[model samples]
Target: MEDSEIDHVMSEIHLGCPPATIGPFLSHFTFSSYPLLDSSNDQSMTISVDKDGDLLLPRRRRRTSPTSHSHGSFTVTIQHSITSTLPDVGLQVWKSELVLSDFVLHNMSLLNGLVCLELGAGTGLLGILLARVAKAVFLTDHGDQILGNCLRNMELNSSLFHPQAIVNVRDLNWMSEWPVEVTHADPKPFCWSLQDFEQVKSASFIFAADVIYSDDLTIALFSMLKRVMSLGCDKVLYLGLEKRYNFSLDDLNVVANGYACFRRYIKEDALCDHSDKKSSFVGKRIDLKQIPQYTKGYERGEDVELWEIRYLIEGCPSNTILIKIQIKRPTNIFVESISKAYQALTDPGFQMGIALPQFLLDIDGASGGILLLWIVGVCILLPLVITVIYLSRSSKYTGNYVMHQTLSAYYYLTKPSLAPSKVMDVFTKAAEYMEIPVRRTDDEPLQKLFISVRCELSLDPKNVKQEQAKFWKQHPAIVKTELLIQAQLTRESAALSPALQGDFRRVLELAPRLLEELLKMAVLPRTAQGHGWLRPAVGVVELSQWLIRVVNCRLFPLVQGSLLESEGISPFLQLAHFSDAVVKKIARKKVKSFQELQEMSLEDRSELLAQVAGLSATAVEDIEKVLEMMPSLTIDITCETEGEEGIQEGDIVTLQAWVTLKRPNGLIGALPHAPYFPFYKEEKLLDSACGCSVEQRVVLSWTKVEP
Candidate 1:
C-alpha cells in the first residue's frame, strides 16, 4: 500500500468518522505530507505517538519488484475500532494520555542492547519504539486486523525505524503454539518470542505496556515469558499504565502471581518558556514496590486496578526471567498517612508503654518469679542428677556429689543477688565507696556493669568445676568485698586531715597493687598443710587499686584544696592546645636531668635521696641511693573498717601518692612529671609511720638532708 493510502486509512480510523472525511481532516490538520517509504527495501518500519499525543507520520509508501521465486516474506494486517460499549470517555481519555506518551518509549530505550517482544501490539506504538532502539523487536497480535493495522502504521512512520530495526509481525494466540507456516529465523541477534509461540527464542528483554486490562491474557503472557528467555541475565520488562482499566478480579490475581520486583516509572511534563513548542515530557521519578499479592495470592473480591510497572526478572540457572503485569492504585496518600502517624507516635514523651495492654504487663509480672525459679530448679537439679549418676557409675568420683550439693546450696542463696534492682544498687554503692564519680544522668549503671562482668568472666578459666564454684561462692564474695572496700576507702579519704593527707595518700597508692596480687594468690591450689589466703588477698588488692585508680584519681582533683599548695600540676590537663616545639623542649630538659641523675655519685645520691626519704644517719645508705636515682614512684595504702557510717567489714579506705623527680634545669616536663624539691625526708617517714602500729616513729633533721 502507498504511504498516502495508509495515511487516508489511519485518518479514517482515528476520526471514527466516515472514510470520505479522512482526506479532508488530514488536509485540515496540515498533516497531508506523506512520510518517506520505499517498497523495494526489505527493512521494517515503525509509527508512534508524538509529544502532543497525536499520531506521528500518518503515511508512507514503498514499492518492491515481484519475483517469480518466492522469498521468505510475510504480510500482516491490523484493524482497530472504538467499541460501541465503551466506558466513561473521560477515563478513556486519561488512559490514552498514559498509554501514548514517552513513558514506554524511554523505558524501551533502556533495553537498547537486547531483543524485545511486544504482545497485543494494538497500534504497534510500543513495539515501534522498541524496534527503533532495541537490537530487534517482534510485534505480535492475535488477529489479522490488528497485525495489518500495525504494519500500515509502521510503514507510515518509517522515519523513526532505523535500518537495523527488525520487526516481524506475527499472529500470536496466547493459548497456542506458532503456526506451521512461520519459519523461525536462526534466532536473530535479538528476537521477541511471543508466549506459546515456538518460532522465537533467545530474547533477553521483554516489554509490555497496558497489557493487564485483561486478567486471563496477563497470566498467559507471564507463563509464556517464563518458558522462554535465558536465565542468568537480568531481563528488563517495562510496563506502563494508568491502572483504572482492569475489569475481572482474576486479572488482578494474575498480576499478583507473575512478577516479583515491580516498580513504577511516572512521567512529568515541564513547561518550556523559550520555544513556541510545548514543554517536553520526561520520566521524572521511579518508585519501587513489591507486588506480593501476585507472587503470593490476593484477598478475595478485591478489585484489580492498573499500575505503572517496571519488572526485573533475575536470571537463574534453572529458571528464565518471567514478566507479569499487575495493576495497583498509586500509594502516595496511603504512604503519607502511615508515615505521619509513625512520626507522631514516635515523638518524645509519647510513651509506648502507655498504649500497651494491661494484660501484657500482668503477664510479664507473673512470669518473673516463676521464670527465675524454673531456671534455678533446672540448673540445680540437672547438674546434681547428672553428677550423682556419674559418681554412682564410677568409683573414683567421690567428690562429685559433694560438689553438686555445694552448687545447689549456692544457687538458692546467691541467685537473689542477680536481681536488677539489687545489681543496680550494688554498682551505685560501689562507685560511691570507691570515690569514683558516678553520673547522675545515668539510669542503668547495672546494665553497663553486667556487660563488663560478662566480659571479665569470659576471660576467666572456663572449666565446669571452676565456673560452678566461682558463680555460687567466689564471684559473689569478690563483688561484695570490692564494694565494701570501695565505700570505706572513699569515706576515709574524704575525712583525711591536711597534715596527714600526704602520708595517707602514699598508703592508698599501694592498696590496689596489693589487692591484685592477693587475688592471684587466692585462686592457686594449696596442699593440706597450708590454707591459702589468696581469695581475701585478691579482694584486698583489687579494692585497693579500684580506690586509687578509679576513685582517688577521679574524685580528689574535684575536691577543693585549701592547705596543699596548688603548685602541683594536674595530670588530667589537655596537652593538645600546646605547640609541638613547646612539648619537645619540656621533654628534652627532663631527658637531660635523667641522664645527670644516672651519673650521680653514690654518696651524693644517697645524701640527696635521704632528704626525700627522711632516712636517719643510722639507716641503710644503699636504700637511700637507690631511692634518689629512681625516676618515678607510686604508693597506695588501704584499710578496712567495720561499723563506720556507710561502711562494712569489707569496706576499704585508700590513699594514693605519686612522686616524679624534678630536673635540675626545672622544666616540670609538661605536667604528670612536674618539678619539686625536697628539703627533708619527712614525707617518707610520715608514710611509714602511718602504716605501722602506734610504736613506730621516724624523724629527720634539715642539716642531714642534702640539697
Candidate 2:
C-alpha cells in the first residue's frame, strides 16, 4: 500500500464513520499475503501473536468438530482468505456466524433432509454446518471472490457432510435486479444463473446471520426475501442478528434503526392497516416469532435475537402443513374416542331385543308355542326400539338427551377420585354433546353447570376460604353463579323460603367471603344491563339487611354493663334506619368507620351532624347514645410531689403500660407548602384511632409492701 492511501484511511477513521467501515482498509496492511521485507520501512506491523509465538494472521482458519451421543461425530473446517490486495472484508468469520453455527449444530433436527440456502454466506461457516444434515445446501455471497472463498471452505469440510448431500456455492448480489422466476423464462438481468435460480426456487429453508446493519443493506435484503418468497414453495427464514444501534446526530441518542426498519417493512408489505394503526389482519398471516433463548458454546449475547419468519400463502394458513401430516397419520385421541363411543353404542347386547317361550303361540306342539312367544315379545319391544331411535334424532328431545348424558357423566366422574382437571374435562366433553350457544348467557344449564363447577373447585375444605375469596374476586364463573343464586332467591314467583334465606344468612355469617360477595351484589342494578351473564343479583331489602347484620356482627364489640351482650362498638354509625340521602351525607364527611368518628371533637361532631340530610337534633342524640355505648381504654398514672403524673424528674425508672392500639407512626405533619396527599391524611386518621386497633388493655393498681 502507498503512504497516501494509508494516510487517507486514517483520515476517514478519524472522521467518525465507525471503525467497521475502515475494517477493509486496515485489512490491506494486516493480511498475511503481504510480502515480508527486511527493510524497516517495508516491515509488516505485528498486530498480535498466538500462544506458539506465530503471527495471528488477519485471514484465519477455524476447525470445529461437534460430537453428540445422538448424532455421532462430524468435523467442519472453514478457511478464510483475502483473494485480492484491495481489502475485501467478506472472507473472515463473524460473531453472528459463530453463534448461528452453534445453534445449527445443537438443533440438527431442524435441518435433516431439508433443502437450505445461506444468504451472505461470507466464509460459509454456517452453510458448512447445515450441509452435514441438509439434503441440499447452497452457500451464497455477492462477488466471485467471496463465492470462491465459500467454495474452498465447502471443499475443506466435504468429508463432514452426508454422502448424498449436494453442497454448492453461488453468487447472489441482492442489490441487482432480477426477473421473477416463471416456467420457460428467458434470461434476464442480474447475476443469478439458471441452476442457481432453480436451487433457490426449491429451497425449503433460508438462514442468514448479521446481515442487516444499515438501511440500504436492509432494503436489498428484504427485496431478495420478497423475490425468494414468491417461489411457490413452503419455506421459512431463520434470521439471527445482534441488533445494531447507531447514535443519530439529529436526535443525539442511540437508536435501533435496524429493528425499526424491519418492523416498518412488515407493516407496509405484509399487513393491511385500516387507518387506526391497529392490526386488521387476524391469525396465521405473516407470522414472525423470536426464537426461545438457547445456549451453545458461542457467546450468544442478550442483544442477539433470532427470529423465525414465514410468508403464509393466500389460501393456506400457518401450521396447516403440520395438520396435513397429522391427517396422513390418522391416529389421534379424537378419533380413538369417537371409535370407542361408536362401539359402545352399537354392541348387540346393548340394542333392544327380547326372547321368550313359544308356548304362547298356541301351535300344535311346544315349539309352536315358543315361536308365538317370540313373535309377541318382538311385537312388544319393536315400538320401544322405534321410539328410542326416533327420540335420539329429534331436535325437540335434545335437552332431555343432554340432561341424561350430563347426569350420567356426573355420576361416573364423582364415582372415582379424579383430578380436578380430569373432572373438568369430562364435564366439558358432556357439554360438547349438548347444543350450546356460541357464547354463554345467564340462563339454563349453563349457569347451573358453571355454578356446579365452581362449587366443585372449592370442595377442598382446607383451602375453601382461600378458594372462595379468590374465585369471588377473579373468576367470572363465580360471579355469574352468585348473581344467578341471588336471582333464584329474589325472583317474584319463587320467593326465597324463610328456611333457605336463614341457611344463606348463616353461611354468610360464617364466611367473610360470602359477606363481601353479597356487599358487591347489593350495588348492582336490579336488571339485565349487558350482553353477558351480568344480570344484577337480588339486591332486595331482605338481602341488604342480611348483609348489614353480618357486617355489624363482625365489627361491633360487646356491651359492658347490661345483661345484653356488647353489640361491639359500631365502627361506623348504625344507619339501618337512615334514609339513603342521610347516609350519603354522613359518608361524604369522611366518617365511614366508628374509629374515624371517634377522632372528631365535640364541635366537629356538631358541625358534621348539622349537615346531614333530614336529620334533626333527635338523630344527633341517637348518634351520641351509640357513641357513649362504644367502649374505650384509658390509662392513669400519679407521682406524689411531682407535677408530672407519670414520672419524677431525674428519677431512673422503667415503666410499662399496655397500649390498646398499634397503628402507623410515620411522619404525619404537612410539608412547608405542598398540599397533603390523601394517603398521608388517611395514615393520620388511622394513627389517631389507636384504642380501636388494640385487642385488649388492662389496668392493675397495687400498694408496695416489704417482702
Candidate 3:
C-alpha cells in the first residue's frame, strides 16, 4: 500500500477521522530536497508531472556506489523522463503512515519563524518540514553520505521552502567543538555564531528527538546542549525528547542524574532562576493544553502522557519544582525515592554522622544508620588497634594476646548492636567506672570478646534466657552486677600467668553475645504478642546488653592499661552526656501533668482546657454540662500588673491589670495578653459578702478588712 493510503487507515483507526483517498491528484506533490547546485553554471531543466501525478525526473542509466563518490562533494543525475515516478523510500513511507506523525508534526511545526538546529537529522524530513515555517534551519549529521542524500532529498521539493528560507547542511560530530562558519555556493554567509544571524542574536532554541537512548551518546548530546545554550541564548532552551522503551532504567537514571547535577550546579552558581520567574518556553501556568502529547512510535498503546518541566532564567536560583509528570508505575516510586535520597546525601548542607529529622532523612535513614554504625565500629577497632598492637608486641606475649581477644569481641558486638554514638557512650561510662585510661589496644580485646559472645549467644537461646532469669533473681540490677563481675574477672585474669590470662580474656569476650541473646530471648515473646509495654522493656534490655558489652570491651582494657597514653576518652564521654540528655528529655515529657484537684467553675475550667487541647477534641460530655451550671464563679489567681493603677485595696479602688492563671509549681498556663482582659479592671471592694473573709496580703496572705 502507498504511504498516503496507510496514513489514511491509521488516522481512521486511532483518531476517528474519516479516511482520505490517495488518488492521482496527489502524484504532483513534490517533497522539497536541496541539490548541490553549481554556482559557476546556469542550466535550465524541464520538469513534468507523471501519469500518477507525482513529480518525475530523468533517471540515471547506471548507479554509482556512494563509496565511489569523491569525499569533498558531488552530485547525482536521474535519467528517467519527467513523466515517470519512482517508489518512495521504505522508511519514509513507513513513518508517513504512522498515526503519531500528526502529533510530531504539529509540535515541530509550532517552532515557526525560530532559528532552529536539529541534531542527527536523519533523512532531514523533520528538519525540512521545520524549515517551511522556521526563519532559518541548520540541519546537521555526522555522516557525509547521509548529508548528501538529505541535500538531494531537499532539492527535489525546493518549491515548498519559504522564499527567505536558508537551509544549510553541515557535518557536526557532537563530541567535537562546533566551528564558527561554513562557506556555501549561494553567496550567502552561513555562521553558527549568534552575531551573524538576527534570530540567533535574539534567541537560539534547540529541538531534539529520540536522543537519550544510549549512555555515552546521551551524555554527549546533553553536554553539547548545555554548552550551546549557555553561549548567549536569551531564553531558556526547549528540549523535546521522544521516550524510547528500549532504553534501560540504568540509562534513564544516568540521564536523570546528569540533569539533576547540572541543575544543582546552575542553582549554586545563581544562573537559572528557580523561583518567581515563569518559563519563557512553556509559560507561567502549565494548563493541560501546554503539555505535549506523546508522538506515535514512542509508545505502543493509547497516547501516553508527556511530561513538561519549565524553569525561568531569572529570580531565586535554588528552587526547582517538578511541574507536570504523573507517576503511574510502582518502579516510578522507587526511582523517585532513590533520586531524593541521592540528592539529600550528596547535598553539601546535609550533615553526616548526625541523625537528621524524620522529614529530612526519610525512612531510608534507618537502613543507612545500620550500615554506618558497622563501618564506624570496624574503623575504630580493627586496623586502629589490632594491627598497631600486634606490630608493637613482637615477643608473642600470651597474656596480652588473651586480653586483646576478649576486648576485641566486646567492642565488635556491642558497637554494632546499638546506635553508633550510644554504643560509644556506654564504653566511655564503663571506662570511667573502671578508672582506666582508655587506649586503642584496650578497644581490640573488647571488640574481639563482644564478637565471640555474640556468636555464642546466637547459638543457644534457651541457655541465655535461663542465665538472664538467674541473674535477675540473684541481683536485681542485672546490668550493674554483670559489669562488676566482668571487671573482677578482667582484674584476676590480668594478675594470672599468660595462659590463664588468655583463658579469662576468652571467657570475658563471650559476655556481649550472652547478654544480647538473653535480651533477645526476653523481648521476642513480648514483640510476638504485640504487647503495649514491650517497646520500653526492649529498649531497657538493649541498653543493658550494650552496657555489658561496653564494660567487657572498653572498661576492662582501660583498667589493664592496654591503651596508649596520648589518646583521651573525651569523644566517648561526650557521647555519654548526649545519651543522658536524651533519657532525661524522654522521661520528662512521657505523660500529661499529675496534680491535686482544685474546685473551680466548669465554664472557666473548660476554657482553660480548650486552650490546652487546641483542636485535639471538640468537647467532653460531662465537662460541657458542668460548664453550663457554673457559668460565673470566683476563681483564685495571681497576676502581674503593668502601667498605672492609683488606688489602695480599701479606697474603693478601680484599676486595670492583666490577669494571669497559674498551673502547678506557679508555671503560667499561657501568657498575659489581650481578649483575656479587654476590660480588665479592679472594681470597688464589695463588703456585702455574707461571712466570707476579705483578706489581702502583699506576700503569701490576703489582707483582712474587719466589717
Candidate 4:
C-alpha cells in the first residue's frame, strides 16, 4: 500500500459511510506500507500486549525511504501491541505523533542547529527525528514508567540520531514542583544539573502532541506553556492533535458535538478562526493550517489537526482581557410592592376591612349594597395576599451579590507613617462605630490594594500640570481633583502632629480621590503625598512598569490560553509579600514576579539577585525562600476591637486592633524580614509619635466620623 491508499482508507473511515478497501490500519502504518488484506471486522481485534505495553509479537525492522529533506531514509524496529488501561498513556504512539513525525521529516530546514523541546513525547517518535537535525533535543513527559519507555525507545534508535547531537529524556510534570531529571548518558558533553530550567526555557522551538484532553490538564498545560513562552526564547510552538470528539451517553450518535470541545479549546488558543461556519487560521504572525491529507501515510492522517503557533515577541495583538466584569441584578418590583403593602397595613390609622354598617348585611332590599361591599373587600385583600405569597417565594438575599458600583475604590498612600494593621484596625472600629457589618475580604484585588506599599512612588513636579490635565481628560467622569483641596482641613493644620497625625489625616482625605483618578487612568491605584514627593512623574511611565510585573504574575496563565483574555497593556498589579523596591529592581531585569523568578535556575536567579543595589547574599537567599514558601491562597486577618461592644454612632473616637498570625498556602513560621514573630498586631490607640516604618500602609479616617 502506498501513501495514496492509506490516505484513501482514512478518508473512508472519517466519512463513516461504508467500510473502505479492508486493510490493517495500525499494522500497515506502523510497518511498511504493505497491504494487509483483512476483513473489516478484524479492525476491532486487540493484539496481545505485555505489562509494559510492549507488543508480544516478534520484532521486525521497518524503514522509510529518504526524500529531498533527509540525507538518508530512517529506520526503526517495533513489536505490535495493544495499549493497557494504565495511567501512563505515553507507552503508545497516537496518530498525532505520526503526523508530527512526518512533519519533522519534511521540514528539516527548521530544526537544523536549533535546540528543541518535545512536550508529551509519547514513544519518542518525533524526538527521535528531531535529534537528527537539531543540535540538542529534550524529550519530556510525566511518570517514571512512561519516561522509562521513552528512554528504551530512544536507545533502540541510537543509530538514527546524529553522533554530535544530544538527545536527553527527562520527567516533566506540569503541576509539580519537582525538578526535571535528565537521564544520564555516557560521553555526555556536560554534567546535567537539576537547575537546567534555563535549557527548557531557552528552547528554540517547542513541540507537543495530543496533550490537551481534560479540562484540568488543559488549564495546567497552558499555564505551563505560557510560563515557558515568556522566557525570551524563540517563540515557536508546533502542536499536533487528532481532533477527539468524545460523545456523551445521551448523544452517542452525534459526531458534531463529539469534537465540539476539542474545537473549542483550539479556537480559544487562537489556533483557528471561525466565521460563517468556514474557518481560516492565517494571521499576521500566527498560522494554524491543517497538514493537508497525503502529507504523510499515517493511519487516519486526514483526522490529524496540525497547528503552527508563532508568537510575536515584541507585541502581538492579545486576545486576553484581565479586566474583571461585575453584573448588577435588576430591581424587583414584586418585593417593593409587598414592602409597601406591609407598611400601609401596619400604620396606626389602618383599617382591617371595608367599613360597612351592620344594617347593610341584614337588609334584603340592600343586598346590592352588601354585594358591593364584598367586592370592595375582595379587590383590596386578594391581590395583596397574592403579592405577599409571590414575594415570599421569589425573595432572595441581594446583599451578598455585591455589585461593581457598590465597591469602594482602593486608596493608595505613599510613605505613610501608619501601619496597615493599624489602618485596618481604624477602619474596623469606624465600621463598628457606624454599626456597619464590615469585614476584611480575602479578595485578591483587595489584598493587592493593601499590599502595594512596597513599590516606589514616582512623582514628577515638572509634568504635574500636564499629567493632571491628561488625567482629567482621560477620566472626565471620575471624581474631580479639586476635591483634594476642598476636602483638606487646612484651618486646623497647626493643631495636628506633623510627623503622623497630619500625614494620616491627609492620606485619609486623599485616598478615595486618588483611587478614583488612578482607576480612571487605568493604572494601579497608588499615589504620593504631593505632586513632587515621589521624585519621578506619577504617569504611565512608572505605572506601566509596575503593571507589567502585576500582569506577569496574575494574568500570564489566562493570556497564554487566549490573547483575547485581555486587551491593551492592562495589568492586574498583583501584590507580593516582598518590598516594592526589591520588586522594582527585579522587574528592571525582566524578572517581573516571584513565580517567574522561581522558574529560573538557582545560579541564574542568584546572579540576578546579587545585582540588586542594596540586597546582600543572605537577604537574597531569604527572599528566595520566602518566594518559595509563599502560599498560593490568601491569608486571613483577625480584627480585635476594644470593649467587644458597639459604640454610639456619634462617639468621638474608638480604639481597635488587628492581628494576623496565620500564614495560608502552607507557609510555616513568620515571613522573611517581617518585624513581628509568628504574628503581626497593631493597635489604633498607639501614640501618633510611636516609631513605625514609613513603608507601612496605614489608612486613617477621622473627619468622616459623624461625632
Better of 1 and 2 by TM-score: 2
Two-way TM-score contest, 3 vs 4, winner:
4
Angstrom error at residue 534, model 3: 97
For each candidate in turn, the TM-score is 0.25, 0.33, 0.26, 0.32
Candidate 1 error regions (>4 Å) = 1-80, 84-101, 107-109, 177-200, 230-233, 245-707
Rank the candidate models, highest lDDT first.
2, 4, 3, 1
Tens digit of per-residue lDDT, candidate 1, span 13-67: 2443354432111110011011212233425656679889898753333222222
Regarding TM-score, does 2 or 3 come out ahead?
2
TM-score of 2: 0.33
* lDDT tens per residue, model 2, 1-707: 58445422121112322444422321111111111122333367568988998877543222122333111123455555412232344666555565566556656787899889888887787886787789998787787777776777777678777878988776677886554333346643224556767777888888888776667788888888877776757677777766657798876999875666665655332354323333221212212123221222334456666566655444333466557757886767578989999999999888665564455445565676566676677777787888898876663333433344444444444322333233223333332223322234333533444454454342467887786666556444334434333333222113433333443333223222232233233333333432211211212222332232222232234333321233233323243234334545666655554455556876677667766545677877666654543335444442332111233344434443433322232332322110111111222212222224233323233333344
At residue 114, give the lDDT of candidate 2: 84
**Superposed Cα deviation of residue 562, candidate 2 (Å):** 99
Worst 10 residues of 4 by lDDT: 684-693
